[model samples]
Target: MPRILAIDYGQKRTGIAVTDEMQIIASGLTTVPTHTLIDFLKNYFEKEKVEAVLIGEPKQMNGQPSQSASIIKGFATHFSNIFPEMKVVRVDERFTSKMAFQTMIDSGLNKKQRQNKALIDEISATILLQDYLRQK
Candidate 1:
């Protein structure tokens, strides 16, 4: 099976992760500026056999749509338009960033690394992908 990719979209930065060809494991790919994410994914999908894409659907504690949801929805629309061959899926991303920070702390990352928002994005994407894997 073709590998799957996950996107953790933020206003300033975006985190990326990908599944193994077998779709069993998720690995952090890279972090990029939000403005450049589409171009990056375009290039990546051209070179990699990506079967689907997963985007984190940010939501509020009350289950209302978060402010970031609009931006993510726009990205999803553009992603589908750009890569009609690939399927796009959205997964709940509540508290994924918090989980990412906890994961970093548990992994012994120091204060500096733990504070790095870029790392959080990557971990968030991984969490999103892992959740997807679990549901499958």
Candidate 2:
């Protein structure tokens, strides 16, 4: 089976996660600058067999779309143009940052380590991927 990937997209950076070949284990892959996202994905896809890409959908508490929704949509459009064969899906990403921070604390990360926003994004992506696996 091919691996499924997940993205935690932010304004400045995007986190990436991928499942194993069997699509059972999800792991953090890396974080990249938003401007370099397409290039990064191009290189990654060139080397790996990805089944689909899962993007985070951040919505308001009242279920309205968040301000970042449009940004994600633009990225999705550009991504599809670049990799039309790869499937793209969106998963609800509310509270993922908070969950990542708590996970950092639970994992005994030092204060300095927890301060890395990039790490938080990567972990958030992992969490999103794990949630997706559970849903499947």
Can you give the TM-score per candidate against the true fold? 0.96, 0.97
Off by over 4 Å in 2: none
lDDT of 2 by residue, 30-63 (tens): 9999889888988998899999999999998898
Best-fitting candidate, scored by TM-score: 2
- Best candidate, lDDT: 2
Residue 129 lDDT in model 2? 98
| TM-score of candidate 2 against the unseen true structure | 0.97
Compared with the true structure, what per-residue lDDT tens digits does model 1 show for residues 1-136?
A: 8999999998899999999899999999999999998899889987889988999899999999999899889888987888888889889999999999999999999999899999999999999999989989
With candidate 2 superimposed using the best TM-score fit, by how many Å does residue 128's alpha carbon deviate from the native?
A: 0.6
Candidate 1 segments exceeding 4 Å error: none
